[model samples]
Target: NCIIAASDYYLDDDGKKAADLYQKACEFGHPDGCKWAGWLYMTGFGVDSDYVRAIKFYDVACKADDLEACVNIGFMFENGAGVDQSYSAARDIYHLACERGALQGCNNLGYFYQEGRGVEKDIRKAKSLYEKSCNDEAVWGCNNLGGLYYKGLGVERDIQKMLHYNKMACDRDLTIGCDALGAIYLHGRGVPIDYQRALEYFQKSCSNNSMLGCSFLATMYASGQGVTKNLKKGLKLLTRACEHGSNLGCNLLKVHLANEKAQ
Candidate 1:
């Protein structure tokens, strides 16, 4: 009912109708509907922008034990949306949601500990939380753990472990993981130096929409490192990387384009 109406409004771009249905659904005790209504109000998607209303609906959803709602509330607090900026409050709510088994909440708490945002800087605690989230199959958690291992933060420098974690993250279809793996291969950091493997990983990451990966792939094609030199293919990838808003990519593309024109 509410869901159908919401979908209809979404398809029609009818914000007013969506807001009304969501409001009614929220009053009927539908937590998900309340959550959607909160987002709509927060972003002014259907109704006039009202952070206070968003906060109220989020509070209601959180009281209903919605972990996502709790996490959203934490974000609002962290960003000072509709409430006084308070990292402590954000941390507390993030902790609550993490305890409730929200992997994103765990990741956020880990980030706070990692950067000493709302808590004492504790690399070890951050690593533990990242590992916990990773074990729970969180892709970002695996990426963070891999980064920590790579940088030897609160853990021994273990290139193999870093590669392992990045692979885990990549298996979950995370572009970051694919890009990291490509870098490791390109630089011979963890695994044996293999241009072919680097190209493969880079292509995977690029296909996943990573501009960095696209740029790297362009270089690989330009230099004939793994694949045969194809200036045209390289140019296309470089152009795409630039269009994706990578300044380095733009520079690289401009240089190559000038060189091609000179030739």
Candidate 2:
């Protein structure tokens, strides 16, 4: 019943009905139903956002051995949403999830170690965890491993390694990876600047809701670095970024305007 209600026939206005049906399915012992109920409550697609309610449903699923539910619970604990902030609890939950074969949980735990949120900072541990996850094809793990190489944390700076990991993530369609790759080429980060390559990557990420990618794309267009200069197109791109909450885009729009007026 819930699946039918939530199929292509589900409309935005039917959030309440969908959530209720999912909750009913949970009552029937369906873990996925419980998970869906929790997610809908957590995100408030068409209902009031209620973290407490979300956690309650998620707990039901988690107790049923849902590793994904455990990871979601950890996120709430990590951020203190509807529950007292407890990094230790979050860490424990992530460990449980990771130990149980949840790759995303391993990535989360690695971040905790890297930032020392609930444990001592251990760059080696973070790197190891990221490596494990990345080797398993976790997109976040690949991107994060690339970050370690870029920042030289617990490892020597290696642009090639950074490029390698980021490319791995990007190949998996990770927007952040695409954005980072674009920046690398645009700024000549340990490599000769290649505006053309940068443009390709920025195009991928920008089209996928990355404001930073859009901002960088605007730079390429405005400066005529790798493509023909077109002030109108540049301004339109900048406007798109600015409307999407990019301070850099807003600032760049001003500069673009001033430059155009001076010409």
Each model's lDDT comes to 0.89, 0.90
Write the residue-wise lDDT of candidate 2 on 39-158 in tens digits: 889999667999999999999999999888889999999999879999999999999999898888999999999999899999999998888788544689999999999999999999
Task: Compose the digit string of candidate 1's lDDT tens values, residues 160-247.
Answer: 8998998898878888898899988888886788899899888998998889999999999997987999988998999999998989
Task: Give candidate 1's error at residue 35 in angstroms.
Answer: 3.3
The TM-score obtained by model 2 is 0.92
- Residue 181 in model 2: lDDT: 96
Q: Which number leads on lDDT? A: 2
Model 2 poorest 10 in a row by lDDT: 3-12
lDDT of 1 at 79: 90
Maximum-TM-score candidate: 2
Candidate 1, which segments miss by more than 4 Å at Cα?
Answer: 4-28, 36-57, 80-84
